[model samples]
Target: MSLLSDPTRLAGLVTREVRTGSRDGVPTRIAVARRSYQTDPADLWDALTNPERIPRWFLPISGRLEVGGRYQLEGHANGVIERCDAPKALAATWEWDGKVSWMEVGLTPVNDGTQLELTHEVPFEPEMWGRFGPGAVGVGWDLTLAGLGSYLSSGEAVDPKEGQHVHRTPEGRVFIRASVTGWGEAAIADGDEPATAQTAADAAYSFYTTEPDSRPES
Candidate 1:
């Protein structure tokens, strides 16, 4: 099934946050997002951890997903599972382009459904932070989470080609713009300078909205 909803509205469903922290004495930047799904915690947890169900919403994944196991997402990040608590939480190392980051997903039962919270932490890089801010990662997660919602609601796998094409559409552009703006506001609330954060958000929006075929190398 196709993603059938107002793009901006779908993007707005996520609550985004940005904060600063330290790990191993090094400063780290944290990006967090929360969204509620109209599904039970057990089902949501299965969708997240089950290899057979992951590609239906997110990317194609391979390798063991259990604790201490390494998993790779095709053409994306590869990671070692650090922790797994069934139907509650999962944590892993997110490695991409020689950079190491950490990601955790927490699931909680809610009145209407299940609430999923994702937190991504990475070593602070002044240059990269100034260029893209938290939106660099937040936007990607927003899209991924949106896909999850669509899949859970419609019981259909998201088409990879369609997912890429959507960003070039006007509605999809609106969605990316709003997601970037939200991340910018989150950074500002975390004590980042307003102007700098918004500037980085604009960069992120442009990068996301651009067609993949024409996108310049980072």
Candidate 2:
């Protein structure tokens, strides 16, 4: 189901933070997002880790898939599994070309489901940061969680073509715009210049709404 066509349970989905920090002397930003699923923690964990179940919601992921192993998402990013603790947490090194980022996800049992929190740590590149701010990536996770929500709520695969088309629609554009704006607010909260942050959000909005390869979360 499309976010625009369907507005079911939106409370669990949120962009928690966009924090600027340093790791190993390299400047970095961590985008934190949270969402809940009406499913068991173990079931949610399976949806994330089990390659066969992943394509039903997320992308088609394939590789060694074990802890300390390498994995690749079809037509998307590839990474090495840094850590994996069942029904609790999973961490990986997200790499594209030669650039390396990190993604860590943790699951907690909620009243009738599970809360999934994801932290994406990105190395600061002046050009990249200046161009898109954190929304360049944050919105992708928003899309990811939204897709996951649809999947967990129903037992069917979300059509990628339909999803791509939805992103180009007016409603989808507004969603992306809000996501970019949220990231800009997050950047300002992290001490960035207001003007610069707004500029970045605008750039991000344009890219997501117009750029051919902007749908990175797919």
Candidate 3:
């Protein structure tokens, strides 16, 4: 088995939790993180606010990024920006019909770098929880954070195609494979069965790596 498959390594990088709904019916919560960018708050703010610069690091986002302005990614969900502050924070209601969800990204300046915090909240259901757990989203965030680091430090995007193609190489593959496996372990640690977590990780990795234009049938 690959070293990336090591359960301990995966667990070290993620934290998992399951919440029971309160009166408002809010239940599940998922958060993920990575360190090393040393992304100062000001620089991190630019990466998020500057339209020309957003795509180089994160997904190409198009929309008026003010509170209540509608936004869409070419192939991702269409949602309204729920909150925005120049370079420190953002939040949006992430939805697909009645399936309402929410995401928030915050930056805290540190002495050496910035700390990025991402929180995604979705209504919890037993079936969906079994399928996604926390790591499903956790691992994806890990990769995105890593990309952000590279972009901030080098002013160059880590080509997803190149990253996927050289996935078999020592560095590239290790990153991808470990991220996938780490997510699976996090899910299991959060109460999902081992087999279920593995399946979720496999499916998520496949979904992320597949070309956007050639998505597999749901």
Candidate 4:
């Protein structure tokens, strides 16, 4: 099977959880995506926090990268570093498009490798939720995780353009659709309506797999 067709190779390795929570008196939801990587906690943490190395796998980051400091991820979100702890956990404010969200990454030592769990919390906006379930974020994390895996295992940088090209093909659509469905079920388990979540999942799948428009806006 092609790499895209093989479920074990490029498919969603992240397990998801949706938790009902409250933020600033507004009912919100926290979507948690968890996955294990074939690297030790220290190496994984360094790959994540080290400014010099992050650009190799993820995006170029420029910021203080300290507690109560500020950070920017390339042409993406810029936020303050709410909390930072070495080789364990980090939390930050994800400020983009004039809105703010919370993001946290926790690392755990499991056997020989490390387990990474990313939790993103946002205020529940029905319209946005109608457009996509957690997969909108979940799939993005999956992409990052895939890149991290490639880098950690082979010491090679994943071409974002080439990776995206594959994700735009038919085989990529199959993987994306499965990711959306998985997130939809996760949302339902967190108390979302069945039909509504499915509709949003379909929209999310289409939004991610479509060429050009599917890519994240700068």
lDDT of model 1 at position 91: 96
Clashing residue pairs for model 2:
none
lDDT, candidate 1, 75-194, per-residue tens? 999999999989899999999999999999999999999999999999999999999999989999999998999999999899888787878777778889999999999999999999
What overall lDDT, based on C-alpha atoms, would model 3 receive against the true structure? 0.63
Question: Candidate 4, residues 1-218: lDDT per residue as tens digits?
Answer: 23344444455677889898998899788889888888899999999999988977788899888999899999889999998888899999989889898999999999869999999998888778767878777777766776777778778766666565767677667777777787899999988899999998887877777666545442
Could you estimate the TM-score for every candidate? 0.96, 0.91, 0.73, 0.90
Off by over 4 Å in 4: 1-9, 212-218
Ranking by lDDT: 1, 2, 4, 3
Q: Could you tell me the lDDT of residue 135 within candidate 1?
A: 91
lDDT winner between candidates 3 and 4? 4
For 34-151, candidate 2 gives per-residue lDDT tens digits of 8788999999999988888888767898889888899999888999999998989999999987889999999999997899999999999888898788887888888778778778
Pairs clashing within candidate 4: none
In the predicted model 3, the residue pairs found to clash are 38-113
Weakest 10 consecutive residues of candidate 3 by summed lDDT: 1-10
Summed over model 3, clashes come to 1
